[model samples]
Target: MDKIQRNERLSVIIKTLCDNPNKVFTLGYFSEMFGSAKSTISEDLDLLQKTFKKNSMGNICTIAGASGGVKYIPSVSEMDVRETLEELAKELSHPDRILSGGFLYMLDIIYNPKWVNKVAMIFATKFSGLGIDCVITVETKGIPIAFATAQYLNVPLVIVRHNNEATDGASVNINYASGSAKKIQTMVLPMKSLKRNSKILFIDDFMKAGGTSKGIIELANQFDSKVVGIGVMIETGLPVKKLVGNYHSLMKLNTSEMQENNSIDIKPNI
Candidate 1:
């Protein structure tokens, strides 16, 4: 292959990360991608991170202290998303790796007790003075993030399931169009999860079309609860008419161009 220009290489790497967040990468991988040395990649990341801040975009954080790697999280100015994704992109970029299915394969990060604890701390810090009474999340994938947020905030977590079942006992269900699934699905949140007149924060792993988010807001209204904020690990840059007016996103997705120009579009929007 021909020599890769520094600016072109940086653009490609950022795009790759936007395509897949919460993925970790090794230094050796970067060396090969850019045909540069480890030290050079490190310097490039530092410069890019500074650029992010200067541009009011976001952060590209480094994780050290054993089992460490680089991660690009979507936090900071451009958008508010968790910061663990930059590292994830590094790992997923390896030529030999295989990631099939619709799954994000984030079990390793989600199951890491230490990381989860730290994440909780971060969320708590953000919501500490926000007067939050409860945390809300959709069923399945979002449970972990929501639980962590609730734990740190010292509030209860309200789960909204996609389908109502006997296991849920009784719930308030609403139908809305899901952006990721691209279909109308019923979202159910138990009636007993929140107190009447409670203040709430919505937390989810990903926000696409925000159909599920809208459903959760409706459920909160049924119990006389008010939504104060919304938090997510990733936010696909689509219309947000379905989401609450005030919210936080860790990362924003730029599906407009996938690898053609800037694939990942990893920028932080507060």
Candidate 2:
């Protein structure tokens, strides 16, 4: 490959590193890929890291150990956070977007492992020093992302089901008002999943009025657990006051700017 081609190839490799949070690539691997010497590969990685940081995009982390490698971490600044959130809000609020029965069709976003992994890594870093012992989420959709976060933090996950099904093996059920219905619904969490005085982080796919979030908080109380923080993949901006506070979100669904064909232009808030 020509010099220009080599630079482009190096950029592609660096982008891949940024996309996978928990993935680490060794210098030997890159050296073989580009048919370049170890020193040349190292210089390319160094240039990529400096260029990325100069653009305020993120950072490249190097691990030093027998099995160490390089990894890219997303760390957008505070100003970028606002701008990205605003763009996401516009995309989410489009008129074509339809939400049925208080639930938004945001599974496409949450099910995306790459995007969700990036989000969890960012949250794990921000809350690493906050004394968090575990991560909790209401069952089904939020399970995958919550599991990812727990995996990153090396913490156990507590799932809150919609009801006490026989599968849960003697779960605890509680009645609480739902966000849209304004009526009571049963929420269940399996016993023995958490312990007393442990700090828990709440993770959910989406948040509207936060009624379910509040229910999780109450459930946590049964075990003498304290909710350290709340996080949502997407938050629909509404007039209703949120029940569970201390929250972080990647994007806000304004629901006024959603376009046709389900293609949403999401701006990264974090």
Candidate 3:
């Protein structure tokens, strides 16, 4: 095989590192792959790290040891996050996005990879330092955000179902009140989905009065697991007394601002 040049090597290394974030890649591996010396690969990494830092793109952390290597951490600048969420807030404030039952139409945003990833990163960043064993979210809209958070944290994703799909096998079922609907609902989680004493991180698309989060806490208790954190993309500002108190929200949905013209206020909780 022909020895790869400098530019090509840098590009390939960056791509490879990005494809496996939070995973270490040894200097020797790169050197062997490109038939370059360890020293040359080190120089290439230094340049790559510097470029990433300079552009505020992300981070490449280098560990110093015989077994040490580099790990990629995808980071989005706070300024960029603020700007993007502010735009999302504006978009969400649209009257058409408001449904009859006071729910926001979010299927489009939840399905959009661009927006979903950004939102997930925000949640993942908040809970990254915690000892999270796996990411959890209920069925429907929360799946995408939960998956993205799990991706960034390099953890497994556990989904709770509104009903027993039967494919999950023997499951533990619990009835919890819906915060917004104020009605009791059944949420089921497979018995094998989580281990006892595991630390869990809950990610959801919306939080009304925290009924769902409270339910999740109870459900986690059934398995003897601890819920380390709860994150919601959008939370209602009113009805201040929520069933669950501890949670991080990316955006605050202020329905009080709903005017006759049909404009709701959206604000970034950052």
Candidate 4:
């Protein structure tokens, strides 16, 4: 076999790290894979680490020990995040997207892979350091965002069902008022989806009165897991008081002016 040149090894190593972010790979693995010496692999990793930092591509953490290895973390700059969200806010603020009862139509953006990936990047950057066990979301529109986040964070995803289904056996259900509508609704989670005390991050497409988030909090409790953080794509401004506390939103929507003026108030959370 031809010896792998430094440039060739570097490219493959970067791809490997990016593909498996947050997963540790020892120098031994790389040495064997590329038929290189430990010293050479170490040098390559060092250069990759510097490149990641210089380009703001994220981080390559080095752990030293018998079981030590390198772990990749994906990140985006604050400036990039601000610019992206500002643009997204404008697109979502269109008057035609407004629905009855002050809710903005977010299905389009959430379903949009390009937009949702950016939203996921924002959340993943915010919560990546939290050592999250999994990314969890309630069923429906939030699935895409949560899945993307889980992908970047290199963690598993757990999706809660809005209704208990026969397919998912032994589910834990909870009742909470639907946001803004003030209608009581039930949501469910399966027993096998989570382990006790698992640190989870709850993500969603929107948060009005924070009812769904609150209910998600309770649902997580049934599994004895803790929600370390909560993130939403958009939140309502009218019902200023939210049932849940200490959460993050990508944008705040002011619905009052939407109907009459065909205008919207979108506040950037970045």
Candidate 5:
């Protein structure tokens, strides 16, 4: 076999690490693949780490010990976070994006791969230190972002549903009051969805009064899990207090003004 060049090895290494964030890749594995010495691979990783840090392109973390190797830790710099949120606020502030019920039309943003991946990176970066076991969200709109976050965090994604599915087997159901509408809503999670004593991270597209987040907390309790972190793409401003505390939101939406004036008044919360 022809020997792989240094540049070729570096490119493949960066691609692999970025593609599978937070996943450990043993040095022996890479050494065997590249037909190179472990010391050579370590030097390459050092170069990549310095480049990533200098360019603000996340991190390449090297794990020590016999079972350790390297992994990508996705992160957004403060300047980048502010810039992204500002751009999002601008895009969502357009009058056409405002819906009838004082809700900002952000389905397109949350569903778009470009935006979804970026926002998910922000969420994953914020909660990266939590030792999160899984990322959880309700069914429907929040799935995309939640899934992306789970990918970055290198954990499973758990989805709670409004109704139980026959295919889900036995499930645990809980009713919690909606923070915005003040109406009761049912949340369903399968019994086998989570293991006991797991730490969960909740990700959602929007938060009115954090009813959904609160519901997620209650549901996590059923499985003997705890919600260690909560992250939402956008949160309303009216509710000075939310049902759940200690959440990170990228953007703040002024629903009242948006409803009254038919214009968006949103800003970055970072």
Candidate 6:
């Protein structure tokens, strides 16, 4: 086979690393693929790392030791994070987005792939170092965001639902009160969904009193697992204290303004 050009090697290497975030690829693997020496592959990786850092395009990390290699860690720069969240807040702050029940209509933003991927990048960047085994979320709206986060983290996505289906097989169920409405609700998860003692990260679209997050913690306990982190796209400013204390929210929505003035007061939490 003809020798692969340096530019060709770099292109393929960068694409492979970015496509499979957080997955290690040994230099030998790339060296064999390119029919190049390991030292040559290592030099290529060094150049790629510098390029990524210069462009603020996440990270290309090299791991040492026999079992180690290289992996991509998806991240966004602080400036990009701020700009993305601010743009989202502006879109969500439109008065027309206020529903009769004082709820903001954000389906368009959350469901849009452009915005979802950007938000997910923020979540993944913040929690990537936590050694998370899986990304978990409740059914429906949070699914997209959680799924994207799982993709960026290169981990499995575990979804918790309100009701169990026969296809779910045997399951575990728990009842918890809603933080805002104070209504009792049931959460269901399949027995085989999560492995025991796994480290979990809960990702959601919104948080009010954080009852849902608290419930997730309780559910994690049932599987003998632990919730290492909790991340929400938006959280209410009211009730100041949440059912759960520790969590990271991208934006803060002022509940009083939305209810009384019919105006939105949302801003980036960062």
TM-score of each: 0.58, 0.63, 0.91, 0.94, 0.96, 0.97
Clashing pairs in 2: 92-255, 93-254, 93-255, 93-256, 93-257, 93-258, 94-256, 94-257, 94-258
- lDDT string for model 3 (125-181, tens) is 678768799999998899999999898877899999988976889999999988878
Candidate 4's clash total is: 0
Q: How does each model score on lDDT? A: 0.64, 0.73, 0.87, 0.88, 0.91, 0.95
| Cα RMSD for predicted model 4 | 1.9
- For candidate 4, write residues 76-183 as lDDT tens digits: 899989999999988987778878865577788999999999999999999988989999998888999999999999899999887888888888888888877889
RMSD of each: 15.8, 6.9, 2.3, 1.9, 1.6, 1.4
Task: Give one digit per residue, the lDDT tens place, for model 6 in 191-243.
Answer: 99999999999999999999999999999999999999999999999889999
Ten-residue stretch with the least lDDT total in model 6? 1-10
Separately for all candidates shown, the number of backbone clashes (residues 3 or more apart, or on different chains) is: 35, 9, 0, 0, 0, 0
Better of 1 and 5 by lDDT: 5
What candidate 3 gets wrong by more than 4 Å, as runs, is 1-4, 259-261
Model 3 CA lDDT for position 146:
96
For model 2, residues 45-109, the per-residue Cα lDDT tens digits are: 78887888889866777767768768775565667556645744564545455565333455655
Off by over 4 Å in 1: 1-105, 239-243, 256-265, 268-270
Candidate with more favorable, higher lDDT: 4 or 6: 6
Q: Could you say which candidate leads in TM-score?
A: 6
Clashes of 6: 0
Across 148-260, the per-residue lDDT of candidate 5 in tens digits comes to 99999999999999998999999999999999899999999989888999999999998999899989998888888899999998888879899888998888888889878
Cα lDDT tens digits, model 1, 8-82, are 767876776544433557666778876788788787778777887687553566666456656555433313223
Which residue runs of candidate 6 sit more than 4 Å off their true CA positions? 1-4
- Summed over model 2, clashes come to 9
Q: Rank the candidates by TM-score, best first.
A: 6, 5, 4, 3, 2, 1
Clashing pairs in 5: none
